[model samples]
Target: MSDSNTSDFTNPSSFILQGIPGLEEAHVWISIPFCTMYVIALLGNFTILFIVKREPSLHEPMYYFLCMLASTDLILSTSILPKTLSIFWFNYREIDFSACLTQMFFIHCFIAIESGIFTAMALDRYVAICYPLRHSTILTDPVVAKIGLAVVLRSGVLALPTPFLARRWPYCRTNIISHTHCEHIAVVKLACADTRLSSYYGLSVVFLVTGVDVFFITMSYAQILRAVFSLPTKEARIKTFGTCGSHLGAILAFYIPYLFSFLTHRFGHNVPLRFHILLGSVYLLVPPTLNPVIYGVRTRQIRDRLLRLLTQKGT
Candidate 1:
């Protein structure tokens, strides 16, 4: 919601040399809102981490992925907020090449991991719901460990090429990134050379990661649906579906906006920049804040634990 203001043309700061995107006026309305959300995201994630660490009962696969998601969400929040807030408050919009890449790497890395973790979470839910009898055997420590490792490694490897490939480009002119954060496509737009390869590579990575991930997610949910249908009573069916309500809510919130942002960028870049920015911002901002409330506060157990912990500290 903020733009760098100190882009001095006379001596374009080291960061300004790469051609700055026009820093549109800052959204004073959102600067503090996002900042507050940043704090909430951090605290929420840390609470999940603490709960998982302290409660041995929660050390299962489902909570494990939830902890991982919390961590990734915290990292995601931190990666973007500093720059965005800086631009909003200090108008110090300049970002060095190294800083930009650093920002880009963390943002995408966390995002990739988030995507992978969500898929893993979907599988966990699937195993728990569809194969309840064998859930423990199906998702053991070693198996979950391997899944975690694979998720991290896959995301890291896939995101590796983005920065590596983008760095090779000779950025001749425009560098001002329109959005609050340095997203991959937006940053790549600054490159002066042929972006066809880079764009293709980026899309290929998305398809390879998100496409496969979403397919698996769908499959897992399908199994869940079938399994739920086999249940006898109305209450049983409702209970089975209840377990996934928060997760489904989170998935919809995360994916719908992401697709919209991607499509708006691909086909409607000419549309009002604010529209794109708004959609993009909602995706980034809402998920983190809403996730804890949706997934944690809505759950009786987690809510009780959180409230009990808060009450303990109130003294």
Candidate 2:
């Protein structure tokens, strides 16, 4: 570890994208756009939450999941964003080891929760599309609440080991994280001690937890499609697909960058340092900016409610 990196870790940071080579200089380019994205994302998602909370009709399993997701995105975005922007704009790169660990913990946890909510949402779509007649009964308040609680608990528990594991490592020289935030990989890699085992463990958790959740979400949607095709009427088919349009859009927007990041992390050194970093930044920024839009554009009920909320408030 270099002396500079070591010193940076001691006092930690306030609002900077620490640890990356040349990031202090590159902030003028990426940081500006990143800050803008954060503002728009925060505004858009909170609008959804406010509208959903104000209106009663919008309350349902699907919207509930949307609310969960919006809330998750808010938490996820705020977790690293301010500090990341601070690093860029304020030139702050110091972060306490404990603070960095907490950041990594939630970064992974909320993302995992997003995955879980998405899976539950797929199941909701399946119930609504495949068993329209039984949707009401199969997706009752109790069931939905159970799923929500389960999602939160599952994501939270999976991340419980992260801080513990991170703390056990003998931190070496520098604490300069190579990315904008305290991302799990970057934080672990900064450890002067051997991080191979810890890195593998974290990666395994990602695959087993988030990856598996995505696989099941895909499967649920596939089953939904098959059931849709079974409908004897064309109108039913359109309705079935329409019901999932927003969800599909949100899923694609959220997961594509995630998939890219996962892949690049697996094989990106062959590319450029900028490549992986850029992809991860996009992954963090894009979903929060786009999620509310997807819901507003596709889900008519939420759209109408949000539109009314905006109009009434002259926003």
Give the winner by lDDT: 2
Candidate 2 C-alpha lDDT tens digits along 1-315: 243534434233321245346555777677778888889889889988888888888788888889999999999999878887777777766666678778888888988888888899999998888788998899998999999999889888888788777777655555556777777776666566777877777888888887888889889988988998988999988987888889889899988889889988987779777667777777987888899988888888877777776798895
Q: Each prediction's TM-score against the native?
A: 0.90, 0.91
Query: How well is each residue in 209-248 modelled by candidate 1, as lDDT tens digits?
Result: 8789899999999999999999999899999889998788
- Which 10-residue window in model 2 sums to the lowest lDDT? 8-17
RMSD vs true structure, all candidates: 3.8, 2.8
Candidate 1 displacement at residue 44 in angstroms: 1.3
In model 1, the runs with Cα more than 4 Å from the true position are: 1-26
lDDT of 2 at 226: 94
The TM-score that candidate 2 achieves is 0.91
Q: Alpha carbon lDDT of residue 16, candidate 1?
A: 34
